[model samples]
Target: MLSPFDAHIDAELAQAVATIAHLRRALEETSTPGEAEEVLDLFEKLLRDLERVKPTVIGRTRQHGASWDAVGRSIGMNKDAARKKYNTNNVQRALARIQDGRPATPHPQRAPVHP
Candidate 1:
């Protein structure tokens, strides 16, 4: 499934698109190279912002209800692609131990096993 970073990137991509649209409108109204360049730079920064957030989604995609399918939807990912990329993607090693058809929530009293 899609990761947390993937989810975040999905959200950021929408924001980036909106930001670009706004800048485009502004550019058409003003038609200044300097201003256009400035907006383009901001666009680049948003792209970088997207880059930074994708990894966070990727790192947090598995847990309880945080299944691959859920992760993929959050990140606008196709199910097959998300599965292909992250099927073996491990989230919490501790969670793996309790995978015998058990609930995934962790209780502090029930200490996690050290691998």
Candidate 2:
């Protein structure tokens, strides 16, 4: 079953693909260079939007109990690479919370000690 976040990502990707296809058709049909340029600019903007969302999606996937290895595999990377790239911001945020005297969210639970 797809998680809600996963489903959302899938939907967004589908929409982006549709938009890209429309833009491609528009580009092919354009009679003027200016129109083609406009379509290309739209494509660039769409790419930028996708780039901006990537880290947020990765972070949220981790929060949703995805392992670094899983994330890496999904993105065609290795576990260490994924963690190094995506975990830095999370670490910085946690440090900021600690500095401000607020406990970081989703604190790890310790196992009970038994005699």
By lDDT, who's the top model here? 2
Q: Across residues 1-115, which tens digit of lDDT does each residue of candidate 2 receive?
A: 8654465457557768887887888888888766666676667656754654466578667887999999999999999998997795764564455456564444343333333
Cα lDDT of candidate 1 equals 0.55
Clashing pairs in 1: 1-68, 3-57, 3-58, 4-57, 4-58, 5-54, 5-56, 5-57, 5-58
Candidate 1 residues 1-115, lDDT tens each? 7444454446667877887787777667666666666566656655665554444445554534476677788778976777665554433321243234342333333232333
Model 1 error, position 45 (Å): 1.9
lDDT of 2 at 88: 54
* Candidate 2 ranges with C-alpha deviation above 4 Å: 1-29, 88-115
> Candidate 2: worst 10 consecutive residues by lDDT?
106-115
* Clash counts for all predictions: 9, 0
Q: After superposition, how far is residue 25 of candidate 1 from its true place, in Å?
A: 15
